[model samples]
Target: MAVTVSPSRPHDTITGTPETGSQLTRIALIGNPNSGKTSLFNQLTGLNQKVGNFPGVTVDRKSGFAQLSSTRRAEIVDLPGTYSLYPKSLDEKVITDLLYDRGSAGYPDFVVVTVDASNLRRSLLLFSQLADLELPAILALNMTDVAERHGISIDIQALEQELGVPIVPMNARKGIGVAALKIVMAERLATHPVRFWEPNDELLPLVRQIRYYFNLHNDYLALHYAQQYRSISFLSVDDRQHIAELVAQSGFDATAWQAAETIARYQRINEVLLEAVTVTRTEKREPISNRIDKVLTHRVGGYAIFLGILFLLFQTIFAWAQYPMDLIDQGISALSELIQSSFAGPLVRLLTEGVLAGLGGVLIFIPQIALLFAFLAVLEETGYMARVTFLMDKLMRPFGLSGKSVVPLISGLACAVPAIMGARTIESWKDRMITIFVTPLMSCSARIPVYTVLVALVVPDRAVWGFLNLRGVALMGLYLLGVVAALGSAWVLKTLLKARERSYFIMEFPVYKWPRWKNVGITIWQKVSAFVWQAGKVIVAISILLWVLASYGPGQRQDAAEARVRAAAPAVATAVPDTTASQELERRVASVRLENSYAGLFGRGIEPVIRPLGFDWKIGIALLTSFAAREVFVGTISTIYSVGQDADLGTVQEKLRAEKDADGQLFFTPARAFSLLVFYVFAMQCMSTLAVTYRETKSWKWPLGQLVYMTGLAYVAALVVFQVLK
Candidate 1:
């Protein structure tokens, strides 16, 4: 096959000048899943990437800026991977909508369709479809090295001629052909206007009528507009109605036309593959991945291995993060002390107790958060996460959940907001809803700080088997408790909410490979940074508000209480040394001010309600404040203790350890600590989570029901634990 080289028309009329007037060229990278598309994108864009959601959807949108040449820069968007333009799932629909709707924000001027060299026929189906759309596209035959290893050879020139597009053979992972890929992208962006596919004779009149009606660019695009007019958001309601009427009048059956188009595209793909590709082997031995899967996916062994990995992950997170966490704590404390000594009065108090303290509370968990993201990224990059989902399907089905539900449930450990969003992929509504409802029962990162503090107090630091640290084991137990609670609650919900439709689980497992360290690092950076920024904004605002509320009272009550404490100071000085007496006087003054403050009044008001769970007034305050977000429990405790700005978790723990009730008994005994842990495990304490749930469900009824049920379960469970242990 011989091809002609033609100068394709530029997207806009500007020649030798930057497109979009200083705006970088917008190029979209799209391909089938596991086709090395993301690897190519990562290589091209490096660290200049940002992740967000597409308009009106929860699916992730990843884009990055790449400098293609000295004078040429491009913004590349990595759309969700899909097998075809025809939509089956929400993610696939997103890709189709973006490609079909030219007015959409993510519409690209040029497309780089990544094709897996090892699977030419299957990968090129999407390429052919894009070609049919009359869009200028570059074919990136990625994973050439893998194809070569598998004894597959491609005639690049012949394939390019057959497909009528620029073909670039490159290994994206090793960066072997990245420079050539960039050169092709820049050239194609400047000039590419060849339409490879032509409409069939039978559909010509329908296509022409639609093209004339809508002023479409070509016949293929018009055909798509006719077939998918309902889903095409760019078209108005009246336009869609008119198009529908026109299609009816022309005898265009969408399903039959789609089927005929698919078959014709496949026949063309097979011809192209046969002409340009060669396979040396007639038969192949089983791959290493299959051999490994036999053992890892075994019913009993898989569960045990999964549990062992889970334990080790938690153990590593707790054991390795301790040193860095301590350092961060000490550094924040030192900074707070410097601020306190450098300033004076209410300004000092607000900065130290309000801003710095709140920041310290959230920043202290950075080490754990980074480690968690790193592990999860590694698992995903290695393709082990897919296997985990497959392994979990059998276990999850009985609880009215799909294997897909495992994703959201596991993601809940990081945070529930996105986890609930992740549940949208589950095709079954009942399974999706149940997954969302019970996901919050899983212990999230917000609850980790609280668990660590309380576990340090009650659980011993000794080892269980010389290799397993006792505290690590205890942490694993807490995580397991959460998993058990989530599954058990899912079971109960399954009974209450009848499934309207049966759901089947289908997933493709990518071949296992060594994790790309660069991608893993990027994932970790993105997740940790997002967590800090998102949570930090809320924490800082609430901290300042809380400080004011805790600092002031209804009237002169705060003034009168401070006067009483100061009046007794001199008499106390007669008995004790002057420095000790002054220090005690300062402590007494702080305590009096806190007790007479509005926060104190509120805590006391709620004391009787939480008293059954062995919570004191101070804990009552933390509980109320934590309803906004669970992690605020630590910040609230730190504020209420009136500890120095230079206080660490150890300082707060010591303060709580020494705290006594009216009967002079320790406040945080084993029973109380366990009760508090149990309460947090089951409580619907995060307003943000509830808000997300409401948004996902599109109704207040579900979120309201969740709050009542989860909170009631927490109260009853905590009450029982405290009553039995106290």
Candidate 2:
């Protein structure tokens, strides 16, 4: 079979060989999940990059530039990792479109097909599909070290002979074969034809027939597995972009390409595996990986271990961050005091007290937030997160949530914005929408401060389960309750919305390795910094805005507050120091300013509606201030409480506990505390969250629905709790 090559693009410079002439180099890197595809991308692109979402979707598109010695600066698109080109799921279709040139997004000039060496047969099915498409592609055999360690060997020469593509071994984690990978990539880019050429036989004719049958007139043959092979490839393509591409490609083809390839690829891949790899005689010998997975994935016992892990995570987050959190509190408080002392005027005091202190209150959650993200990063890097979804799927599916949703919902335990964003992977719109809607119910880290304060004030620290810490267990229970609520809500949505076929739960159970410390560190650093930066900006801006609103009001309000405070001094305490009177005078001045300000007016305006919820005007004011974040409620209380006192970090909690209503009874009673908890539990209280949610989902619609339903449920539940407890 002789082959002819020609330059497809004007900039292409191919003389005798293939892609050498293709100037606008668009190469896609795709593979099975856990095949080290991302690690390969990191090696190729290093520091040259951009992260953007695909058009009309929230799924991330990470494209970068690679300077190959031979190809020069080539445009590289690191596609979402996918197993096959079939059009069943979005991710798979994204790769399909790139491979076939199906969508509005231009097609790739070539593709780098990544394969996990240990899972050769399954991975190669995708490679074979790429071959059928006749695309200029190179097969990158990733995880060579793991393959060798597991008694797996690959005859690279034979695979190349069979597939007509170069097979390069790579251990991306250690950069062992990266130099070779780049050389192969560069060589293929310069030597292959601008457009792919097939041997021109039954395979090409059959692929064409199917393309015509499916009406996929443009290309994308790899995604149109003949009808018989559809089910297998269907499981492989998870991303929406990939599936859309496959569907578009298949829409043209009338023939079935599915049946032929399933048998053909499996036989060839299996033969290759038999010749190149072997399993050890010591099958009974438990590798470290199996030993851990045994306990972690055990059907009955696994659930218990999962709960135990949740318990430990929250305890560490709440307990460990305390010392650092307290130190930050003290530092910020000292700074505020210094500012007050340096500037003697009322304006200076307002800036220090109302603005800076309020900002400090919001930032105080950072330490705990950082630590929680660190743990999540470790879990993800080590690959335990998949197993979590795997185990959770069984329970979650019964309640209208897909098992894959467990990861995002659990992620919401830290923050809902990213969790909502992460739901983009769900193939079904209904599933994704349900995931976005209910994820907020997963008791996020934002609720920790409120829980800590309440548990300390109401529920005493005690032990239960014999050796288990009871307070920690209670906290875990609250977190689990949120998960339960999420599942329940998702189920209701599932029932309400028209259902689709159950998604293929096809996920790679990657061989566990000791997590890469560098990857872990980078992940933790990025997440922590992003969270802090995002929350910090909003917290600061809102604090400043709130200060201005609370500090100065209109007309007679300021005059009246001053006169009342001044008149009370002589009648109530004649022997009090002039200094005390002056301090009282300042308090009166601050109060008048706040009452006349915008923030105060807003809070007071909503008082009537919130009054039945058992909150005073101060609580109402705090509610308005905390829209920046739920935990802002705590900081708002701290700042507002601080303004009237000489209290510092050490005495803030005590001051809060002793706060009284107009009747002189404790305002934060058991009934009130429980009511507050329920309110936080349900209210669409975090405006910053709503804003982020809107950006991620691209709608006022979903967030609006979320706010209405959650807040309504919260109101009813809290009302019930208050009535019953009181």
Candidate 3:
């Protein structure tokens, strides 16, 4: 069998030689999920990292610059974790695509495969596959500390000899053995090696034919091209057609061949492990993880514990964050007053009432957002998140969603943008689409401020059961309502959008461990920072825009209203003979000016439509502004009421409490507050979420449908709640 070798291009080798004067070497870090890959990446890259989407896919691509040595700098790309090159999910496919397509921008010069030292048997499968690709590879044996606890040991030299790769045993969580790993990476990037795995007799002839036709130097590379030619993005139409014809002629059954390859690979792995790995001791004892999983995964006890934890989380978010939230609010209020006192004119009003008020609204929610993200990060770091998914899978399946949907739905509580992005893991289109559709219905942290303000207005803060605060209980009820709505919507979607193929959910349950505080802190920082920066931009812009609309109107209506209020002020004061009369006159002037402003006109136009839901024109204006983001509702209300009421210094909630309707009834009556709460719960008010939905679905149809259905539901539900309560 004659195999034609392609010319040795710089891009062909796993550790490609850098071009003259180019000081950077590109390295790819590949690993199975829960193999401590991200921990290692964070340790190596520190703050020099950037996250982006992979080409032609929504899956995240994280890359960072790492200084391997004094003179050696490397760009490390952290490829999504996968079990093997034959991908079962979209994220896993990223690994195969980048590796098989040398023309890909993410194509690496060398590969560092991180494997769990405690689970060598399972981790070696991917390492072996990489070796078969004829790439220069380093094995990073992470979690060695955990392996020691389990009485597992490995002979490093023997493993290196057996696998024909350098094995660096490291505890990534503690930053151990990282220096040794870097040194090995720097040394191995200088060499190019041939394929490590020899093809079996049955596959050799076919591999040779593939190599010859494709001009491939490596047999394994040819094998992968034969298997994945159709899905490989780098292949041209002509190349794919030629490869297809050649593959057809060779009578290659991709499924059968892949199965054979896997079995053969495992057989070789057993041999390697036999010579290299050792079980230092075997004891008849239950693992700590297994012992804990018994209770955590128990049918009755599990749910009780989960509910208790959720209650505690909400309680903490509401209770612990109250102090910080108040501080932020006061600081922002003081700053706004300072800015107003210092500057005079429209710019000052815009700065204090518009921009600063909008920012204050967003920043006040930071305490809750940070707390929620911190809890989520801790759950994920402790590996308890997987158990939650596992527990919810049974419930999720009945709702027409795959087990994978649970992850997105649970994460939706934080933010729908990434949660919707997370739906990519669901292989079934119907399941993924349904997950995206209903994810936003879950009240996110953005809704926290709105919910807190409204709930505090209506629900008493006293404890319900002498321990559970009524406020916390109300918050939990809102969260539960969202979950019910999501599942109900998914059920309806399932009945409407029929599936052509069967859906299957497969996931790995990682062993439980103590949460890594550093990883948890990094995750919280990233999420909270992204939230503030992204939402802050929209909030500030909307605040300024709302200010412009509310400050000025057509035909000098605002000027006319202000002059009329000034003309009546002296007569009203003479009749009333009290300071309250003067204050009421000023309040009336502010109300009249707002009623005649552009924002008021727009709100009145929609008032008839939303009036049955107990929403007046002012609330209607807030509804319009909040579409940019839900948290902007508070800012919109604050800005509208703040105009001309400069003397009445009050928080958004206090101002809302002071608002009165045409009948002299409180605008935020319990009925109105509850109705508004219900409306926000179901409304598709977030434009960012809609944009993300479009990006994920690659069409406006789904997001548009989502907006219409959710908005309609909100209106109808709010109407019913208001009518019943009123």
RMSD of each: 5.5, 7.1, 6.3
TM-score of each: 0.81, 0.76, 0.82
Model 3: number of backbone collisions: 2
- Candidate 1 lDDT over 505-578, as tens digits, reads 76778878888899888777766665566555665666678788889999899999989877776875646658
* Winner by TM-score between candidate 3 and candidate 2: 3
lDDT of 2 by residue, 493-539 (tens): 88887643455566667676667666665545544455455445655
Top-scoring candidate (TM-score) = 3
Better of 2 and 3 by lDDT: 3
RMSD in angstroms between candidate 2 and the native structure over all alpha carbons: 7.1
Q: Distance (Å) between predicted and true CA of 413, model 3?
A: 6.3
Of candidates 2 and 1, the better by TM-score: 1
Best by lDDT: 1
Q: Indicate whether candidate 1 or candidate 3 has the larger lDDT.
A: 1
> In every candidate, how many clashes are there?
1, 50, 2
Worst 10 residues of 2 by lDDT: 1-10
